[model samples]
Each structure stands twice: as structure tokens, then as C-alpha cells.
Target: MRVLVVSAPLVGHAFPLVPLAVALRDAGDDVLLATGGGALAAADAGLPVHDVAPGFDFGRIALRVLPRHPLVARAELAGTAGTRGAGLLFGALNDQLTDPVVALADRWRPDLVLHEPFAVAGAVAAARLDVPAVRQENSLFDGRELVRATGARLGATLRRHGLTELPPPAAAIAVAPPSVAVQDGWPMRYASYVGGGELPSWLREPGERPRVLVTRSTLTGPGDRGPMPAVVAAAAQVDAEFVLVRPDGRSARSLPGNVRVVDWIPLGEALPASAALVHHGGAGSALGALAAGLPQLATVGPGDRRHNAELVARRGAGLALRPRDVTAEALTRLLTDDGLRAAAGQVSREIAAMPAPADLVPRLAALV
Candidate 1:
């Protein structure tokens, strides 16, 4: 089978598709990954790549909301109204890339098209070609519901665009643990959970001192421009050594003697030894920590971080704090809290026993 995978521009949005693409290739299916950014990373991983037109500028939207209030910004972006923002963002994105995507579909003529929810243009193109189109949602938010809810609010706009009829996805594959609830009343015939990806190489090792991994999600990149400084400051007060992953190297400033910053490290290499993690609570990061059984300190910035943080706290695996208000004292409390650590361990064990991506492939095959 020939499969064309459509992904968004950001690394966070694109990376979750890697394991599935690799699985498809290994199974003797031809897989072509089409993305706007992180094409090099995917190509380096041995997946065939096709560069599509650039998607939306959510980074600009994030910058607009970060400094003023991370929580409110996140709420606005992830809430029902924010779904409209997503639709507008992708509608403009689709408008920009429609011609190229249509051309690609015409040329590639794959058996199926798998896409990130934000890459709506791929969905439209697949429809135009009359091929099966499946959406892969890797984050905590529900895209089908978000889009459906947004469509209700933008009924006139949707009607104006002749989108009154909802397009049923061939499948919606969610990459979350089974512990997470799949939304009720969604079209289950086409919607299923596939679970999260494997640990990166770095988290597999055992270390002496308790390690604390700090990152601002893959999308935040490595720039002093994000909330890392606050994490560094808070981490300085803890007993553990910090393994900081700033792949972009934009955030290398005066560092504490105990803090070590690297451009990149496999999360699997670091998480096993780490007693706790501090992150912006992207779904991948949160699930990585859960897989490792590490307690978390979530300094939620934007997007699904707030919801992920709430899940973390509800699961009793960690504490959630606002980026603006995070302090060394708070970090120390979460790291040293025994009950939280034990609870995190329980959650981790639960995640570890769940099915991996390898197990999800057949289910995905059934979807196709």
C-alpha cells in the first residue's frame, strides 16, 4: 500500500507520526511523509519526505499570549472559541497550500492519506481524490469535537463555504494511553486510540543522583525566548542535576553549575533515572514522563499544556504551576514530595503495561 501522511509545521505536531510511519515502512508499505517543518528530522529518521506549503503561524499566536497570561491564553486557544481559531488557522493554511496538495494527491495517488488534524487541506485534497483520509491526533485535545463545536458557532461561515455537511474521517487515531478517556458519542466506527510512541534513546540509562529533566516542549524549541530560564532558576534549588534539552541552542545563558544543557537528548535515556521532570506539559512530554514513572512539575505555557497539567495533577503524579508564578520553593516541594512521587510511580506502571505503537499498527491497518 502507498500511504501519504500529512503533518503540520511544528516538531511537536509532526514527531508523533514518526513511529507509525516507520511501522508502515517496515511492514512493506510505501510511506511518504508530507510536512512543512521538521522535514529534515523525519528524512533523517529514514522516512521519505515531501515538502508541502507552510502551514499556519501558531508560533506568532503563542508569542502573543505567552507574556500576558499563559493560563488564559491556553484556555482561549483550547476552548470552544479557540477551535474557531484553529479552523481559521487551517483554512488559511489550506488556502495557501491547496494547489500543491491537490497536485501531490493527483500525482501520488496513494491508497490512503493520514493527516494531522491541523492539516485540513490534506483532508480536502483526499476528498477531492475520493480516497480514504484518516486524522491522527497526538495531543490531549479532541480535534473532531473541536471542529464540530466550532462549526456550530461558525454555522454561517461554514455554510458560506458549503461545509454544512460534516466530513467523516475515515479514521481518527488518538495517540494516548487507554487510561485516558476517549470522548463519548464521537463516531467510534472511524475513531480509535492508538497510544503514545516509544521512549527516545536517552531515557534508557540508569544514573546515580536523581535526575530532573526540564523542557518547554518540542514546539518551544531551544531559545532563551521561552520559559526555560524560570525552570533553570527553580531547578537550581533542587538536589537533582538537571538535564536540559534545548535542541535549538537559543537559550544558552549563564547556567548554574549543576544544570547541564544539551541541544538534544533522547528522552528515554534520561527519564528512567530521573526522579522528577519539569516541562511545559505537551502531551508527548507528559506521556514520556508517565512511561518512565517520573513525577512531574508542570509549568504550563499554552495549548494543551493546561489540560495535560490538570490530568497530571488529577492522576496524583505531579503538581501544576503557572509559568509566571513558578518558584524554586515550588520545585523543591514537588521534587521532595513522597506521596506525589509514589502516585507518579503508580501511573507510570499503568502506562508501561499499555500497548505500544507496534501493537497499534494492525488496528490502524483495519481502519484503512
Candidate 2:
């Protein structure tokens, strides 16, 4: 079977879908991954790929789109930006990518289309081709909310392509542990895939002290320096060694003695030695920490970060702090708290019990 996997121009969107694509490839299906920013990461993972949004960067799109759309601009986690506003914002994004994706799908003639939720282009293309489209869902964020919020915008776009409506997803490959996703989806174990990077030699070797992993979002805007100062303060308060995973073109402005920086590495690779994690609440980071059995402190940012932070906290595995409140005190609590670690371990066990992507491959044969 030929599979076309579509994703938005962001790694945060694409990374969650790669595992399933890889699994399908290994099962003798031809898999083609489509995206803009995440195309490199997918290629690095050995999947064949097509560019749907050439020359368009996720950062640039965020800057351009957010300013024009006030309902979504600086919208807090699910803030007053109702579904309609989110839907319109999502509609425009999907609309921008739809033509290219549809063009690709028309040529490829894929038997199945797999997509990260935000890439509604995949669903549209699948509908055009009369093929099944599946959602590889993981994040607490739901693209459906944004799509549903779109009202006539989405349908109108569909009508332009000779399509009157979008069909329901053939399946949802759920990866989030309970309490995170709004509804339970068909279970597919998350197959972890962080972008291409080598694990540092020092990180590989055993260490004397309990280590803590720290990271910031890679999708930062020009003015966004992120919470580096808070991380520095937290490092100073903790006795543990801090390994900061540096995002591209970003270096620590100031580093505490306990904090050391390394180039991009998979958070999964960093998890075993990590006693705890402190990070901006991107979906991948939050879910990765839980999968690894590490306690976390999610510094809430705009978008789904708050949803991720709140979900983990509700499950007793982590703490959520607003950006202003992320401090040494919070770091100290995350490191010292025994209950958090225990809860984290418990959730880790639950995640481990789910069916891996490879395991789910046979089930998808029917869909194809």
C-alpha cells in the first residue's frame, strides 16, 4: 500500500506522526511524508517525503498569521478565543497548504492518508482521492477545535475543490495517556522520534549526581528569549547537574555553574539519567517526560502549553507554573518531591502498556 502522511510546517506537529509512518514503511508499505519545517526531520528518519509548503517557515507563518488574527494572537491556552476564531485561523493555515497537498496526493494516488491533526490538508486530499485518512493524535491540543471553529471557512474551501464536505477520520491513532485527550481514541503506542542529533558522549556516560534536563521551544519568535533567566535561577538552587538542550541558533545568555548546554538531542535519550525535567510545555516535551518516568515542571506558554501543563499536573506526575512563576523555588520542589517521581513512574508504566506503532501496523492493512 502507498501511504501519504501529511503534517503542518512545524516539528511539534510532524514528530508525533513519524513513528507510525516508519512503522508502515517497515511493514512493506510505501510511505511518503509531507511537510515544510518537519520535512528534514522526517527525511532523517528515513521516510520518503514531499514538500507541501516550500520556502515557508513555521516561524514566519506564525509571525505573519498571528498578528493578522487577533482572536488567536497571543491567545492563552484555550483562552477567550472561541472555536470560531480558532477554526478560522486553522482554516487559513489548512487552506494555504491544501492545494499543494492535493496536487501531491493526486499524483501519488495513495491508498491511505495519515496526518497530524492540524494538517487538515491531508484530510481534504484524502477525501478528494476517495482514500482513508487517519489522525495520529498525541497532543492535548485538538485541531478539530480549530477546524470546527472555522464555520463556513473550511467548507467553503472544500467547495472550491469540488468537495462539499470533509469526511470523518478513518481512525485516530491515540498516544496520549488518559486525562490528556478530550476523548479516548484508538490506542497506538507513541513511537518516539526527536529530530536528527547525536547523543553527547558525556550524556551517554554515567554521572555522579542526579541530572535534570531543561529545554525551551525551538519555535521562538525574534523577540522571544524564552525563560532562560528562570532556568538559570533554578539551576543555581538545585544541586543536580543541568543539561540544557540548546535549540538551533540559541545559546544561553547566562549559565549557572550547575547548568551545561548541549546541541539538540532527543529528550528520550536524555530521560534515563534525568531525575526530573523542566521545560516549556510543548506537547512532545511533556509527553516524552511522562513516557520516560521523569517528574516535570512545565512552564506554561501560549497555546497548548497550558493544556499540557494542566493535564500532567492533574495526573499527579508534574507541576505547572506560569512563565512569571517559574523559579528556583519551583525547581527545588520538583526535584525534592518524592510523590511526583512516583506518580511519573506510574504513568510511565501505563504508557508502556499501549500498542507500539509497529504493533499497530497489521491493523492498518485493512484500512489501506
Candidate 3:
């Protein structure tokens, strides 16, 4: 089977699809990834990739589209309204990529077009070719709702592609743990892939203190550090050793003797030895922590960060606090709370019990 996979041009957006894509490839199917920008780095995983949207800057697109939609603009990427705004912005982005993606699909003629929820261009291409479009859920939010919300905004693109409406996905590949999010479709165990890197000696060995992993989202826009500054300020008050991933040197100026800043390390590799996590509520970070059975303290803010953070808290696996609410007390609780630890372990086992990506290969191939 020839499967064409589509994703938005961001690491957080693209990385989630890697496991299933690799599964399909190992099963001997022809797989090609269609994305651009930072997501193009997915090529390092050994899959053939095509840049469907060259020179695409999501921050630029967000700036242009957000102002026109005040509800989304003012929401600071929080709440249902903010998510709706994201749907519209993604719709606008799909408008730019539809023709190219459709053209690529025309040439590639994939039997199945599998894509993350935001890449509606994949849906358009599938409609244009009369093939199956499979929705791959990479986050806690439902793809169908997002696509439905985006419907009106997609009028022009649908018309251009000779489609009256977007087709429902023939099937779905859901990765979110069921307890954390009520995801639909075939349940596949989420295997976290944080890309490759040289591991530091400290990461390979257990730290002397109760180590807390601190990180932020990969897409925090220009000049926006999210909650890192707050985390840094509070780091001094916490007694545990803090390993922060990839903070700018300027942000690292503080002499917090307990804090260690590394340029990069794979979360998948680091989570096993860590006691807890503190991060911006990116889906990747939240899921990775869950997979490792680590309690989390997710700093909620704009976009789907709040959404992701709240779900973890609702399940008792962690705590969700606004950036301003993040403090030393919260960090302390994350490391030492017994209830959070048990809930996190339960969620981890739930995730581990889900079917592996390889188990879904036959089902996906059968769709063709």
C-alpha cells in the first residue's frame, strides 16, 4: 500500500505521527511524509519526506489570522474559543497547502492518506482523489470537532478542490490514553520520540537529589518564553535538582546552584530516572511523562496547553496551574505527593496496555 502521511510543519505536530509511520514502513508499505518547516527534520528518522509548504512560518500565519478573529486573538490560545481560533487558522493554512498537497497526492496516488487532525489539506487531497483519509489523533483534543469547527472557514478550499464538505475519516489512529482523553478509533500505545541527541553523563545516571525535569514547548513564538522565567525564579526555592531542557543563555543567568540547563536531551531517555516533571502543557511532554509513570506539574497558558494540562489534573495524574500560579510549593508537591504518583502509575499502565503501533498496521492496510 502507498500511504501518504500529512502533518503541520512543527515538531510537536509532526513527531506524534512517527511511530505509526515507521510501523507501516516496517510492514513493507511505501510511506512518504508531506510537511515543511521544522517538521522536515522528521526525515532524520529515515522516511522519505516532501516539503509540501516551503517557507511556511506558523507564527507568521498565526499573526495574520488571529487579529481577524478577536475571540481567538484575545483568548491567548486558551479555552474552547481559542481552540476554535486554532481551527480557523489551520483552515487558512490548509488553504495555502491544498493545491500543492492535492498535486502531490495526484502524483503519489496514495491508497491511504493518513494525517494528524490539523492537516485538513490531507482531507482535501483525499477527497480530490476519492481515497480514504484517516485521522491520526496526536493530542487530547478531538479531530472531528476541530474539523467541523473549521468547516465554514474551509469553504473556498473545498470549492477549489471540488468538494462540498470534508469527508469523515475512514478510520482513526488514537494515541491518547483513554483515561486521560476519550479518544476514538483504534487505540495505539503512544511511544514517545523526542528526536535524537547525545546524552549527557548526568542523564545516564541517577542524580543525588530527587531530579525534576523542566521544559517548555518547541513553538513558543518569538520573544515568548512561556513559563520558563517563572520556573527559573521558583527553581531556587525548590530543594530537588532541576534539569531544564534548552533555555536560552540569557534566561539561564541565575545562579540557582541546584538547577542544571542542558542544550537538549531526549525526554524518552530521561524520563525513566526522573522523579517528576514540570513543563509547559504541550501534548508531547504531557504524554511522555504519563508514559514514564511520572507525576507532572503542567504550566497552563494559551493554545491547547491549558486543555492538555487540565486533563492530566482531572485524572489526578498531576496538577494544572496558570503560569502565574506556578510556584515552589507546587513544584514541591509534584515531587513528593503520593496520590499523584499512584495516579500517574495507573495512567502509565493504561497506556502500556494499549495496542502497539505494529498491531494497527494490518488494520490500516486493510483500509486500502
Candidate 4:
């Protein structure tokens, strides 16, 4: 079977989707990952890639959707949870990929379309191509409402492709802890794959003290750069060492002693040695930390990050902090807390018990 795997063109989305695509590839199925600008990142990771929106920058659309500062953007979400912003951005991003994906699927004739849940373009393309479309869960919470919120717009777009309504996913690949699955699907074990990169030699050696990880979501573009400085300050207060992953050109400043910053490294490689992760409540970071059984201190932000943070708190695996409320003291305290580690272990065990990605291949093959 030939699989067309698509996702939002970002590191976070690519990281999670590739593991599943690799499983299929390893199982002797042909696989190609299609995205916008993220195709370059995927190609660097050694995946066969196709570009839909060749020059698409999600950050450009994100800045447009919430043009104000982070505080104003934060307040906008706080009001209606910014359903309008989410819908509009979803429409914009999907609009870029929809036609291109449909064209590629038409020429390529893929057997299945497995995609990040937010990439409505793939589902619509699959519907038009008459292939089984699978909605791969992108976050800890259900975002079906966002898709439904833009139903009129999405429906109108699909109409151009001769699709009257968007078809339901042939299968839904869910990696979130089952308790948090608002819309359950095939529960697959998360075979953690952050990127196709080699771990640095310095990272291989054990740190002098307990190491802490600080990161934010790949989707939080230029508009949300405010949190990085605060996160760096908080890490300075902690007695442990800090490993900051994927902090780009603009956000990589203000490093105190006992801190090491790397442009990119697989979380699977780094998490095993770390005591805990301090992150914006992105689904990738939260689930990745849980996969490693590392305690987490999540700073909640827009979209489902708030819900994901609440789940972290509810499960007792970590403390959830609001962006305005987070402090160096809280960072120090989370690093020192024993209970968080214990709670994290429980989440880890749950993830381990789920079916591994390879275990899911034969099952997905049957769908074809």
C-alpha cells in the first residue's frame, strides 16, 4: 500500500507523524510525507517528501490571525477561547494545502491518507481521491469543534473538489492517555520520534547535577516569543542544569550558567536523562515528557494547551501554571518535587501498555 502522510508544516507536527509513517515504511509499504514548508524539515530528517504549499509559512498566518502582542492574543483566547481566530487560521492554512494536496493525490493515487488532525487539507484531499483518510490526533484534546466551527468555509472549499461534505476519518490515530481522549480512536503506543537527528556528544555525558528541559511548541511563532525570556529566568533559579531544545535565533538569548541550548535534538534522546520538563503546554511536549516518565511543569497558553495543562495537573504528573503566574520559584519547586516524578511514572506505564506503531501496521493495512 502507498501511504500519503501529511501534517502541518512545523517541527512538532512532523516529529509525531514521521514515526507512524516509518512504521508503515518498515512494514514494506511505500510512504511519502507531504507538507508546506515543513517538507524541507522532513527531507532533512531523511523522509521522502512532497511539497504542497512550497512557500507557506504558518507563522505568517498566525501573526495575521492574532496580530497583537502576546498579552492581547492571550486575552483574546481567554474571552471566547478565540474560536474565531482558530477557525480563521485553520481556514487559511488548509486553504494553502488543499488544492495542492488534492492535485498530488490525484496524480499519485495514494491508498491511504494519514494526517495531523489539524491538517484539514489531507482529509479533504483523501475524500476527493476516494482513499481512506485517517485523522491522526495532533493534541491532547479534541479539536473537532475547530473543524466544525469552519464547516461552512471548509464545506465550501471541498465543494470545489466535488466533495459535498468532509468524510469521517477511516481511522483516528490517538496517542493521548486514554483518559484524556475526548474522541477515542485506535489507541497506539507512542513510539517517540522528535526528529531524524543525531544526539550531540555533550548530551551523551551525564550532567553534573539533575538536568531540566525547557521548551515551547513549534507552532508558537513570532507572536508568542514573550515566554522564552521568562523561561530562561526561571531555569536560572533552579539548582539543576537546563537543556533548552530548538530555541531559534530570536529566542535563544539570556543564558545563565548551568544552561546548554541546542537548536534541535530528539526528545526521546534527551528526556531519559532529564529530571523534568518545563514547557508550554503543547501536546507534543506534554506527551513526549510522559513517554519518558519525566515530571512536567506546564505553562498554559492559547488553544488546547490550557486543557492539556489542566490534564497534567489532574493526573498529578505536574503542576500547571498560567503564563502570567509562572515564576522562578515555581520552576525550582517543580524540579524538587518527588510526587510529580511518581505521578509521571504512572502515565509512562499507561503509554507503554498501548500498542506500538509497528503493531498497528498490519491493522491499518487491513483497511486497504
Candidate 5:
């Protein structure tokens, strides 16, 4: 079978789909990835890719769409407001992608289409080609609700392609642990894929003290060091070694004595060696920490970060702190709190109990 995989132009939207795509490929299915922006990094995982939106600027689109909705701009979008914002933002993204993705799908003649929730363009293209499309949840939010909200924005695109409305996916792939977010559909273990990078020799083993892994969002500009400086400052007061990922333009001379910086490394490689994690509450980072059984401190940011962080805290696996609330005490608790560690371990076990990606290949094939 030939499968066409579609993703929004962000790593948070793209990377989560990698494990399943790889599993399908290993099972003798041909898989082609269609995406843009930060998601282009997925090619580093060795998947065949087609850029659906050549020279598209998603950041610019976000800037144009977000401010039009004040609540969304402030990250206060929730309930109906959240749904509207998701439509305006992700709908705009899909609008740019729909034509190109449909063209690609028309040429590829895929038997199945797999997509992250935000990449509704995949669903559209699949409908156009009269093929089965599957929704893969990559975060804690409801994929159905988000997709429903995108309907109004996609009307023109749908009309252009002879679709009255977006069809529901043939099936859904659920990865979040039930303790954090209860979801329906085939349960697959959340797998972390942080792309390829050179691992520093020092990272191969545990450090002299407990190691705390710290990271920020990949979507931000190099100058936007959200909550990282505070985490680094708190590292100076703690006894543990801090490994900061992609610290961007920050220099070694200005960093704390106990902090180490790496431009990039796979979290799959970094988590096992670390005692705890500190990061902006991206869906990928939060799930990666839980899968590793590591206590984490999720500094809440805009959009789904708050939702992801709150779920982590409510489940007793971690804490959600505002940027100003990030301090030495919270950082220390991430390493020293036994209850947090235990809860994290429990979540990890729950994740482990889910079906592996390879195990779901036959089920997806049956759909085809």
C-alpha cells in the first residue's frame, strides 16, 4: 500500500507521526511526507518528503491571523474561543497546504492518508481522492473538536475540490496516557523522535550529580529564549547539572557554572541519562518526559502549553509554572520529590502498556 502522510508546518505537529510512518514503511508500505516550515526537519528521520508549501512563511501567517483574535493573541482562548482561534490559525495554515497536498495525493494515488490533527488538509486531499484518512492525535487536546472548528475556514477549499464538508477520519490513533488525557481509538505508545544530531561524548553517561534536561520550543526564533534564562539562573542555585538544549545565541561565559549547553540532541537519547526535565510544555516534551519516567517542570506558554502542563501537574507527574514562577525551589523539586518520580513512573508504565507502533500496522492496513 502507498500512504500519504500530511502534517502542519511545525515539529510539534509533525514529529509525533514519525514512529507510525516508520512502522508502516518497515511493514512494506510506501510512505511520503507532505509538510513545510519546522516540520521539514522530519526528513532527517530518513522519511521521503514533499514540501507542500514551497517558500511559505507560517510565522508570518500566524502573525497575521492571531492578532485578529485578541483572546487567542493573549493565549486566553478556551472553550468556544479556543475552537474559533484554532480554526482561524490552523485553518489558514491548511488553506495554504490543501491545493499542493491534493496535487501530490492525486499524483501519488495513495491508498491511505495519515495526518496529525491540525493537518486537516490531509483529510481534504483524501476525500478528493476517495481514500481513507486517519487522524493521529499528537497532543492532549480533542482532535475532533479542532477539526470541526476548521470547517468554516476550509469551505472554499472544500468547494474547490467538490467536498461539501470534511469527512471524519476512518480511524484515530491515540498515544496519550489515560492518566493524563483519556482518548478513544487505537492506543499506541507515545514514542519520542527528536531528529538526528551529534551526541556529545559527555552525555553518554550520568554526570557527577543528578542531571536535569532543559529545553525550549523549536518554533521560536533564536532570540526568543522563553523561560530558559530563568531556568539557567535557577540552575546556579541548585546542586544538579543542567543540560540546556538549543540555548541559541547564549554564550558559555554567561551561563551558570553547573549548566552545559548543546545546540541539539534527540530526547530519546537524552532522557534516559537524565534524572528530570525542565522545558516549555510542548506536547512532545511533556509526553517524552512521562515516557522516560522523569519528573518534569513545564513552564507554561501560549496555546496548548498550558493545557499540556496542567495535565502533567494534575496527574502528579510534574508541575506547571508561569515563567516568573520558575525558580530554584521548583527546579530542585523536579529532581528530589519522590512522589513526583513515582507518579512519572506510573505514567511511563501506562504508556508502555499501549500497543507499539509496529503492532498497529496490521490494523491500519485492514482499513486500507
Candidate 6:
């Protein structure tokens, strides 16, 4: 079968599709990934790639807007009502949503289309081509409140184009653990939990001292908000060595004595050594910690971060703090607290026992 995978320009949106694409190729299906320039380099290595248009550089836009329009920053960091505003602000910058993907569908027609949830253009293109489009959600946009918050603006855009009445696609894949409960009302009939890519080579097993992992989401570009200095301070207070991974060089600034920075370290490699994780609470990062049985200190900033943090705290696996309150004292407490650590380990074991994506891939394949 020939599958066309449509991804957004952002790394967060594009990277999750990589493992699925590789899986499809291994299964003897032809997979072609379509996105803008943002993920072209990664796709070029092996996966077939087709550029939809010039990618949107959200980092540059954030730097310009975050200071003056705090709502823009909130939208960029917190996954709240602000995302609708950001989408509206940036949507006018490119018309690719309606044009490029539709044009491409005309040329490389495939049996099915796989798309990121935020990649509205790709979904529309699949609809236009009259092919089966499978929508993939990479984050925690699950409950009714979150759905209403994030989808309001995009829904309006579709309505304006006379596309409001269309039913949702054939399937929706959740790339997270099933423990992360989603609203039952979502349109998806099928949901699968897929973890992130394999672990990197540099990580070591846990030692005598507690180990903590610090990372931001890969989608948040270099200029995106991160409390690196505070991360360093927190590591110092906990007496833990910090292994920081920022895939896009977002956190490459001056480091403290106890902190080690890497451009990209696989979570699989880093999680086993980690007693606790300090992160921006992206779904992938949160699930990575859960899969590893590590507790989390979620310092949430933007979309779904707050929700993911709430889940962690509610489950008793960790503490969730706002960016401003993520102090060294809090970090120390999270790292040393026995109850929270124990809860995290328990949750991790639960997550590990759940069905892996390899099992679900064939189920999805059967749908086609």
C-alpha cells in the first residue's frame, strides 16, 4: 500500500511521525512524508519527503511577540485559549493550508493519508482527494475543555470554507499511554498509544546518587521559553547531575558546574538513569518519563503542558509547578520525596506493561 503522511512544519508535529513511517516502510508499504522545510533534513536521511511549502518559523515569531503580547507567549507555552489566537495570527501568513497539500494530493494520490492533528491543511487535502485520512494526536488535547479551547478558531476557519459539516476521519491515533485519560466524546473510533523513538547511546544506568533528566520539547525552537538557569540551580540544590537534551539547540547557553548539555540525547538512553524528570511537559516527554518509571517535575509552559502536569500531580507521581515557581527548593523536594518517587515508579511499571505500538500498528494497517 502507498501511504501519504502529512506533517506540520514544527519538529514536535513532524518527529512523532518518523517512527510510524519507518514502521510502515519495514512492513513493505511505501510511505511518503510531506511537510515544509522544518523536517526536511530528518526526512532526507531515509524516509521519502515532499515539501508542502516553506515552513513557518515560529521561534522568530515568538521572540518578536512574547514580550509585547503575553497572550502570544501563553499560547506558545501553555496550550490554552491562546493557541487559537496564535493560529489565527499565523494562519494568514501562509495559504498553504488550502493550496499546497491539495495540489500535491492531485499528483501523488495514495490509498490513505496520515496527518498530525494540528496540520489542518493536510486533513483538508485528504478530504479533497477523497482518500482515508487518519488523524494523529501527539499531545494531551484530550478532554472537552482542552478540545473546546484549542479547536475553536480552527473550527471557525473550516466553517468559513464550507467544510464544517464533514465527519472526522476514519481513525485517530494517540501517541501516549492509555493511562492518560481522554474525553470519551472525541470523534475517533480507534486510539493507539505509541511511545517515542528508541533510547540514545550516551545514557548510563542509575548510580548511587539520584539522577535527574532535564529537557524541553523538541517543537519549542531555540528562542522558545525555558528556565535553563533555574534548571541548573535546581540540579545544584538536589545534588544531582543534570543531563539536558535540547534537540534544536534551544538550551545551548552557558551551563552550571553540575549540568551537562547535549544537542540531542534519546530519552530511552536518558530515562533509565533518571530518578526524576524536569520538563516542559510535552506529551512525548511526559510519556517518556512514565515509560521509564521516573517521577516528573513538570514546569509547564504552553499547550497541553498544564494538562499533562495536572495528570502527573493527580496520579501522585510528581509535582507540577508553573514556570515562575520552578525554584531550586521545589526541585529538591521532588527529587527527594519518597512517596512521589515511589508513585512514579509504580506508574512506570503500569505503563510498560500496556500494549506497545508494534502491536497496534497491524491493527491500524488492517483498517486500510
lDDT of each model, Cα atoms only? 0.64, 0.76, 0.85, 0.75, 0.85, 0.64
Where does candidate 3 have its weakest 10-residue lDDT segment? Answer: 220-229
Global CA lDDT computed for model 1: 0.64
Worst 10 residues of 6 by lDDT: 184-193
| Model 3 vs. true fold: TM | 0.96
lDDT of 5: 0.85
Q: Give the distance in Å from residue 25's predicted Cα in candidate 5 to where it truly belongs.
A: 0.7
Could you give candidate 4's per-residue lDDT for residues 1-368 as a string of tens digits?
99998887766666678778888998899998887564457666567888777777776777776664455466645532545656667677787778888888888899999987667888888888787988777677564665565444576688888888777888887788775445568888766456556788766666888888878666654324424556676666768888777776665676788778877677678778778888887777888888889998887666656777888888889888876566778777777778888889988999999888888898889888
Clashing pairs in 6: 77-301, 77-302, 78-301, 78-302, 78-303, 79-302, 79-303, 199-268, 199-269
lDDT of 3 at 256: 88
RMSD, every candidate, angstroms: 5.4, 2.3, 1.5, 3.0, 2.0, 4.6
Candidate 5: which stretches are off by over 4 Å? 76-81, 221-224, 251-253
Write down the worst ten-residue block by lDDT for model 4.
220-229
Task: Tell me the TM-score of each prediction against the true structure.
Answer: 0.79, 0.92, 0.96, 0.89, 0.95, 0.80
| Per-residue C-alpha lDDT of model 6 across residues 266-310, encoded as one tens digit per residue | 566666767788888766667667767778888656655777788
The best candidate in terms of TM-score: 3
* lDDT digits (tens) for residues 1-368 of candidate 1: 78888876667767777777777789888999877664336676788888775544656544543445545444545432345445544444545555676678889998788877676656666777778888777566677865454334344433434555447777776555445435322222111112234545545654565677787655543221334667666666767677777623544567777787765555656666677888876777777677667888776544456677777887788887777656777777777889888887886666566555566566667755
| Order of the predicted models by TM-score, top scorer first | 3, 5, 2, 4, 6, 1
| Model 1 error, position 120 (Å) | 2.3
Instruction: Kindly list the per-residue Cα lDDT of model 2 for residues 1-368, writing each as its tens digit.
Output: 99999988777778778888888899899999888864456788898878888786655555566677665674633433435444655567787889999999999999999887778889899999999988778576565554455424677678878877777888877787764555345786665678878898778654777788878886765323345557776677777888878843434756778888888787788688778888888788888999888999887666666667888998889998876687777777888899999999998988899888888887777886
